[model samples]
Structures are given as structure tokens and as C-alpha cells.
Target: MPASASASSTTPAAGSTIHLPKTSESEQLLKIRHSMSHVMAMAVQKLFPRAQVTIGPWTETGFYYDFDSPEPFTEADLKAIRKEMIRIINKKLPLERIEVSRAEAEARIRAQNEPYKLEILAGIQEPITLYTLGQEWWDLCAGPHVAHTGELNPQAFELESVAGAYWRGDEHNAQLQRIYGTAWETAEQLAEHKHRREEAKRRDHRRLGTDLDLFSIEDEAGAGLVFWHPRGARMRLLIEDFWRQAHFAAGYELLYTPHVADLALWRTSGHLDFYSESMFGPMAVDERLYQLRPMNCPFHVLTYASRLRSYRELPIRWAELGTVYRYERPGVMHGLMRVRGFTQDDAHVFCLPEQITAEILRILDLTEEILSAFDFRSYEINLSTRPGKSIGEDAVWELATAGLVEALSRKGWAYTIDEGGGAFYGPKIDLKIEDAIGRMWQCSTIQLDFNLPERFQLEYVAADGSRQRPIMIHRAIFGSLERFFGIMTENYAGDFPFWLAPEQVRLLPVTDEVLPFAEQVLSQLSGAGIRASVDHSGDRLGKLIRNGEQMKIPVLAVIGAREAETAAVSLRSRRDGDLGSLPVAALLKAAERANLERGATLELASPGKEHS
Candidate 1:
């Protein structure tokens, strides 16, 4: 997924009776939110007569209205708007839908002196309509509103906040104040919505990134550029190593590609025409233009075109952890989830057209294996068909779509069809993983492109000694390394599993006399391929444990005189509480087992007890 596209809606919490559905999921929410936006507009106009309404629409979470006010709205204005909205809701006024001619609509707008509504009227199609609130206030709208304001629970709605927005989202146009608000069927659902929002805030990646000392975005250097600290770098390396191993096991060979190429390469690949907006400006070098790559697919295509291939070399899978850069607008740049510079775990497969089904199945299997390791077993899959403005033969598009559907069926994964949602160049499959908090994050995609192969003339010799274009499949398990890191951080709430944690174990020495013993234990753990460090801060035992817990270390071991003499260590695990006193050898064995199995918790047995 692109950095600009963030995660989707939240699901109902487990064991909770209240289910907070998104506006898209429920017809009642659609009507309620739609009516709420109009009610809010009426209240705003009643309070600030000079505020002219532009547009008010419902979102997945709630609704927002844009207004061209004389002055920006303040925090106090939001409270006043809420109070006024509640008052209007209490009036039990009938919301009447009125059909009018364009002339009448324009006449009413002229009478009200609302220029924004006039502009909106000019763009819309015929059968103009407006909704009247009570007897005095009204606005142009297409009605699916509640019968009356009495149907709305005044206590169920809230005015969220106010922000500045450009009219029609164009920076060149007039600026407007946008008021965001949320409404639900009942106050209980509203409470649940607020709780989820607060929980999301608590698990925000930016705060966790700082508190855990993982990564940072330095303003001095630039915006949207990530600086991975030592601990973060270590965890990233672990992820990379696992990715490499998984790809190799799945019959993939890794490749290294340049970050910048001649500007003509992009033109030949058609990216210069289609993706120029997201690309950085080209740089002049030696009388030629070189541009930073916003994608890795073109580079892989270049590699395939560089050499002629035979039929026997079909189904070639090549993967790359390629770093790419794009130009993100300043205000749109988020933490690690949305960055200008990030690594893409990109892979491309060149195979015969007939082998699409098998190749897609292989990719899906690998995706599941990799994602399940991080404890994301639940998924929502989407199969997007070709758009109307797409480039491909009808037969080819049908074949590609069929291949995706068949592969999904063979894998027994349920998917929803999204009409006209694919890229202009291909039909694709998108997979969204559900996080621990019931939020869904899009991280994996498999796109079958028929245009790239034709554009680059990527071909191989057929069995009959004729040349044929190879089918190209672009796949990425983690869409962007930085974005995936952010999602995973929030999913785990910064307390990473034992196998993936940067510091798996911390050794706390009881006193000065046990320093040497702690060192020996650390060496043993390190030799066993466990990341362990001796806490040499010389703080009290209680403080040491507290600090270790604060850092979210998986395990904390206490080294004391008796344990040292007995060749044992008292262990406290974040996932498994106290394990009593276990021998150093047992600790090393359990740590190795956890790493090998990618287990979340370590299982260690006492001297005479059986392992659990």
C-alpha cells in the first residue's frame, strides 16, 4: 500500500455487546450521519450567520462539513456548535425533502448570498434538490435523511475538532474550516467509538517509537526520512534475515538494483507519464537527467529485458529489498507509516501465462507463512478486476482475473470483488491483516501486470522456437518496510514477542559480588544466539527490574551469590511470570528453542520439573 493510504476501520471489541459499525457497513449509520451533517450545518449557520457551507459528507468514521467562515473556528466554537446542534435535535423538527429546478436553487442561493452553494450547484447534474430543516434553515442536498431531528439521539453525537482545508482539496483554491463530528445510534455505541479512538491514540506508533527508542524522523535532516536507531536497526535486520530465508525457501533468488537510473528508463516504462506526481524532481548529471526510483518493478523489468531467455528458464522469481524515494507533501507525511524514503520488499516473477495459477498459489502460501509468524492469522482479502480505463486485451484480462480467482479458491480464502478498483495496468489481489485491537492494516499485495511485459518487450523463447511475452507478477508481503514496522509496533503495543524483540533478555546482578557471574551468563546467552545484556547501571535490584520491564524486555534474570554458586538463575518473564530458579544451561536451551520456533513465550523447566 502507498504511504498516503492508511489503515481501515475498527471492528467490534471482543466480548463486547456493542458493535460500532462504520458508515459504509450500516444503512442506519449512513442516514444518521447524513442527517447529522445537515443538522450541524443548520446549527453552525444559526450561531455564525456569516459561515457559508460548501460541502458536508459522511466518512467511514463520521461526518465533516466545510465552511468558508470569516474567521477560523476556535475550540470554544466546537463546544458551542455541539450545544446548538443538540438544541436543534431537540426541536423534533421535520426534515422535509424539496425538489426544485436549477433556476430555483440558484435563486435561493442568491437570496441567501451563499456563493459556495452556488459553485456546488453549477457542477451537479439535473434534478436538483434541497432538504429543509424546520421552517427557516435549509441547504442543497440529495436526501436519505431521517424523518425528523427527533430520531437522532442528541447525546449520541459529538463535534470532534476543527481544521483548515482547501476548497475541493485544491491548495490553489480558497481555504475553508472543516468541522469533524461522529454520531451513532445510541450513547453506548458512541462511548465504544470514543474508547476505540482513545485506545488507538494510546497505541500510536509515533509515541511508542519514542518511548521504546526505536526510530525517529529528524526535522533538521528533512521530513519523511526515517532514522533507525541501534535497537530498531537490529530488529529490522532480524526481519530482513527472516525474509531472505523465506524467499530462498520458496524458490526465489535475491537481486540488487540501483536507486537511480537514467530518466529515459522511466519514460520507456511509462512511469514518467503516470507516476510523475509522486516522483521527486529529476537531477541533472553529466548533461543527462537521473531520477530517484519511486518503484522497484521497472528495475526488475530492465533486468529481464537485458537478457534473452529460453523456455526452460520459465517461472523465474527474483526478490529485492530495494530502497525507493518519493516526494510526499509536508502535511501528509506521517511517522514511519508514511515516509518519503523506505525499503520495499519487492519481488517479481516471470513465468509462462499458463503457469499463473501455480505461481499465484505459491505466493499466497508464502504470504500466509510469513504473516502468521508475526501472529496475524486473520485476513480480509480483495480481488480487484480491471478498470474501464485499463490497458489490456479483453481475453488477457479475463484469463488473469480467472487465474486469481482460481488460485484464491484453491487456497480456500474468501474474498470480496471490488469492481473497477485495480490499477490501470493490472488486476490485483490485496490482503488486509487484522491487528490485535481489531483494526485492519493492508500490508500484502499480488498484482498481475500485462502492460509492463509488453512495454518492456520482456519475452522468452517458446517451446516451438517462437518468442512470446512472459507474464509478470509483482508481489510484496510487506508493502513498505517502514509502514509494516509501524503497524507491527502498534499491533504488539511495543512489547514484541520473544523471538523478535531487540533485547530478548536482560541480566540484573543482585550485588557487586555477582558481577562476574552475570557476565558469564550473558556470554552463554550470546553464544546461544540469544540477544542478552548485563545491566551494569549498578542500580538497586527493584529499579533494575522496573527498568527492564519498562523497556519491554522479554526476560529478566537475577544473578545472586546463591544462584551463582548453584549454577542457576532466577528468571522473570514478561509472558510467563516467574520461572523460579533454573540452571544456566536450561535458560540457554529454552532461549534457543524460542528463537528456533519463533515462539512468543519461553518454556523452561526447573531441575526436577517437566517442561511446559
Candidate 2:
């Protein structure tokens, strides 16, 4: 998804992209990394005495120390800082924790003339402790650090980068230079970490989105709003088409809802009360306040309430690619991954109480099918039970919770139980997908709601002609197309599978003589529903091939005089190497089969044999 549309399919060796555990997972590594941050600060202060340290803390990967410096740090400064840190680590300085009174802490901070530290000291409660690194440096901290610097592996640490950050993240305060670094338990762990970081940067969707001319976020248009260019829009249409096919095949009816609704609808739905913080301000429309939708569930609910239904039609499955807008605070949005405006692949299922387990199981199966279609084969599932403060009767909560658990058990998906983590209205199941490089991203969620139905007073005719409330379940597979697209782009490193690529094939004519032949081949491919384009730039044959490959086009058809005469094209595939020569008809059949099967590539090597 970055500048490089990598066609490299070779996964890093099993242990090469090994996971560097979170700071909270390993106490020893946590202490080492935390101590490394302090060591880095000490080294920086020793070199640049004018620098005043503020907050230094360990992140999921490593640590960062924010300092108010006279000038911004340069690339050369990182090398100098690393050298100083190594010298300090070699000294094996003993880190001693000293408990001090607030007065004493204030006095020490004042003596050092660090206004940032003094401010931090004032805000913290009593029983302040200071960890002194020998006689050279000391700072206010609540640490569980190693006793000595010798416990750290010098080879395992590296100074990574520096950026400008507001002091305490307040733009009004002095801007501080933040130096980021990562320290691991061993050199191998560090190497794996570096590898992952490098790969992540290469796969960063924000960069590739521009390089591939896919999508963009404009400052003038508004923050967190995406504009899908032609190529991106074409791929989105393909994705949406595939999604509709799957949903219809799975017995789901699509729905189209208004973007703005009466504010009373949100108030009745409890969104105005509970979710107002995320909602946009209401607008007056002919004296009636109308609110931009932040969720599509309320509208779907009203649709059910529009008419009475019988128990015979208990399960009403409706889906929508509903675009919703929510207020995202400035400085928090990142590319398409975190956007204020996004379209959610949302669905809601209303069924009889007894149908809960079977329905949930069906949803899970559907989720797996949809996710695996995009190559997200592995998942981490979590079943969150009712929270301490939640609606619905205890019996209803137990029934819904047990239904989720039973469905997961029947699906044979091992999941972790999160105690009291459900939404105030219902229990929920959260799913995170692991990508090719071992990065995990939370996407899908299936939430069982009992409160909304009760709030809306939704009912259906029972078998005995009595009115009964139907159970409601809310679910989302891709969460948001914007986010899933970003994840997918990064996962494939912008080299989409053959069936998913916007431009599936490019016909490259080696000579002007074969131009007519290229046009004929294009027509055949297009007739078969394969996205194909003929390069008519009049560039050299090699330049055409290079340009096709650069765009990550799946199939590059080399049409020369020889190919034209024979009614064949030499295919150079990005997925599988050179497919020597194929009759235009054979090529059409292979491409069609791949598209029909949603296969990643055409395994032409063994003709009829699939790649498995």
C-alpha cells in the first residue's frame, strides 16, 4: 500500500517476523525498555545540557522521551545520542529508587531548573519516588526498572526517530522534541522488530494511496473525509458487487436509508443521550431539528416498526453499506483507517428468542467466509458479557450471552472471555484479524441487543396470536470499508490479487503491427468480464512492460508480430513467473475460471489443476 507495490510473496521465515510482545506482557522487558528511555534521556541531557526532559514512557514497541530543546534534533543527532547511550550502558550505572516527600521532590526538581518536571511533580500525589542513575542523573518516577544498566543488552536497542510533539500533548504549551527508540530482550528480537517496522512503513496505506492514485484526504474538503479517485472507485464497486452477491446468496435483503433524520428519532433511539459526544450537531429544517446519522440501526428499527409481522417471518435479515458521520477530534484522524465519515457494512437480524443460537452460528459462518475471501484466515475472538451498568433483565442478558457462547463453541472458535466489557445495551462478540506480517487489527463485531427492541416497543404476532418482542442482533463484517480497504492494501502491500486488482490485465504491443491484435485480445477479455486495458502510449515494448508491472497489473500480455500471427500472447505474471505463451482463447478461459472461483492467480502451469 506504500510507494512500493511489492510482488514478493516470500513470507519472512517463521521466526523472522516474530512478535515483540507488548510492554504489559513481559515484566522484564517492560522494565528494561522503561529504563532504556531514562538512559536515553540521561545521554541526551549529558550531550545537550540545554535540553529539559519532560515525560519519558515505554510504548507497545519501545520507548520515547520528550524534551524541550533549543533546536530541533537532526538525523546526525540520533547517531550521537546512540553513542552516548552506549557509553552510559557500558558504565553499568546502578539505578537506585529513593522515596522522597513532595517537598523534597519539589526542591530537587527546582534545583535542576526543569519547569516541566516541576509541573509534573505538582500534579502527582504524595509518596513521590525518584530513581537516581548513579550520581549523574535523577528524575521523578514510579518505576519497576532493572537494578543496574548491565541487565540491558546494548545490541538490542536502537535510537529510531525524532518528531515535534506538544508538551503534554497540549498545542498551547512549548513544543518538545520527541526521540523514539526500541529496546528488546535480545538482538534477534530487535532485528525482528526492525523488520516489522520497515515492512509496516512500506505498507503504510497513506503513502500507497497516493502512489497508486487510489484515494485521498483533502485539507480544504475537510479532515477525515476520503475522496476515492477513479481507480479506487472502480475497485470499490467491484468489492461492493462481490459483497452484494455474497449477502444475497446468504439470504440477506439490502436496504437504503436517508442520511439525515428527525432528531426525535435519535432521541427515541437513545443515541442523543448516550452517543451525543460522537454525533454532529443537529440542524434546523423548517423548525424541525434533523441530525446526520451516526448509526443506521435506528432507521432499520423504524423499518421493522412500519408494519406488524407474524412469527412465520421471525428472522428479518437486512444489510446496508450505510455512510455515517461522527465528529473526530482534530489531530486524531489518520488516513482512511480513522475517519470521521465512513461507510459501514452493517447488518441487523431480528429473530425469535429460541432462534438465537442458530442465527449467531449462521452469522459467524458468514463472517468467516467474507473475511477469508480477502485472505484474513486467522481471527482472535472475544465474548464480552454484560457490564456492571447495563440495561435488560438478568435473564435476558444470560440468554443472549449463552447464545453467543454456544454459537462460538459450535463454530469451534477458541475465544477469550472479557468480563463485564459489553455495551450498556447488550453483550457483544469482538473479532480481530491477523494479517500476513503478524499484525492484528480489530474489525468485525457481532452485538446482541435486547434494549433497543424494548425501547422501540417492537413486537410481532406469536403462534397463539399474542404480541411478543423479537430478539435483535447487530453485526458488521468489514466494520468500515475505509478501514478494511486500508488493512487490505497494507496486507497485500498494494499488490492486490488477480481477481481484486482494478486493472486485471494489460495488453502490451511490441510493434505497431500488432496494435490491432492487442485491441482484439482486449475485446475478448472484456467480453469475459475480465478488466483489461491496452497500452497505447506508443512507448517502447520494454517501457510498456515496465509501466504495467509498476502499476501492479496482474497479467501483462506481450503481443508481438509472432504472437499476432499465432493468435497467442506471451504472459508474464506477477504472481507466478513467465507463462511462456497462451492462445488468446486459453488465456480467456483461465482468467474467467480465476474470476469465477475468486482465485488469486491463473495457475496456467498445470492447465486444469488449481493452486489449492
Could you say which candidate leads in TM-score? 1
TM-scores vs. true structure, each candidate: 0.96, 0.92
lDDT for each residue of candidate 2 in 1-612, tens digit (9 for 90 to 100): 101111122235245655567786689989999899999999999989999999999987799999999977999999999999998899999999999998888888888899999889888887889899979999899998999999989999999999878887866778889999999999988887788778889899999899888999999998999999988888899889899888998889999999999999999999998899899999999999999999999999999999999999979999999999999867668898999999999999999988999999998888888888899877778889989898888988888899999998898887889999999889999988877787778899999898889899999999999999899999999999999999999999999998888889999898788899899999999999999999999899789988988888899988888889889888889988787778888899889998888889886635422211
The Cα local distance difference test for each model comes to: 0.90, 0.88
lDDT of 1 by residue, 1-612 (tens): 211112345667656567777788889899899999999999999999988999999998789999999978999999999999998999998999999999999999999999988899999898888999999789989978999999999989899889888898877799899999999999999999898888888889999899889999998999999999989999999999999999999999999999999999999989899889999999999999999999999999988888999979989999999999998877677899889999999999999878999999999999999898888888888999989899888888888899999999898887889999998888999999888777888899999998899998888999999999888999999998999999999989899999999999999998999999899988889988999999999999899999999999999988888888988788898987877788889889988999999989797654423222
Q: After superposition, how far is residue 465 of candidate 1 from its true place, in Å?
A: 0.8
Question: Candidate 2 vs. truth: CA RMSD?
Answer: 4.6
Estimate the TM-score for candidate 1: 0.96
Model 1 misplaced stretches (Cα beyond 4 Å)? 1-8, 606-612
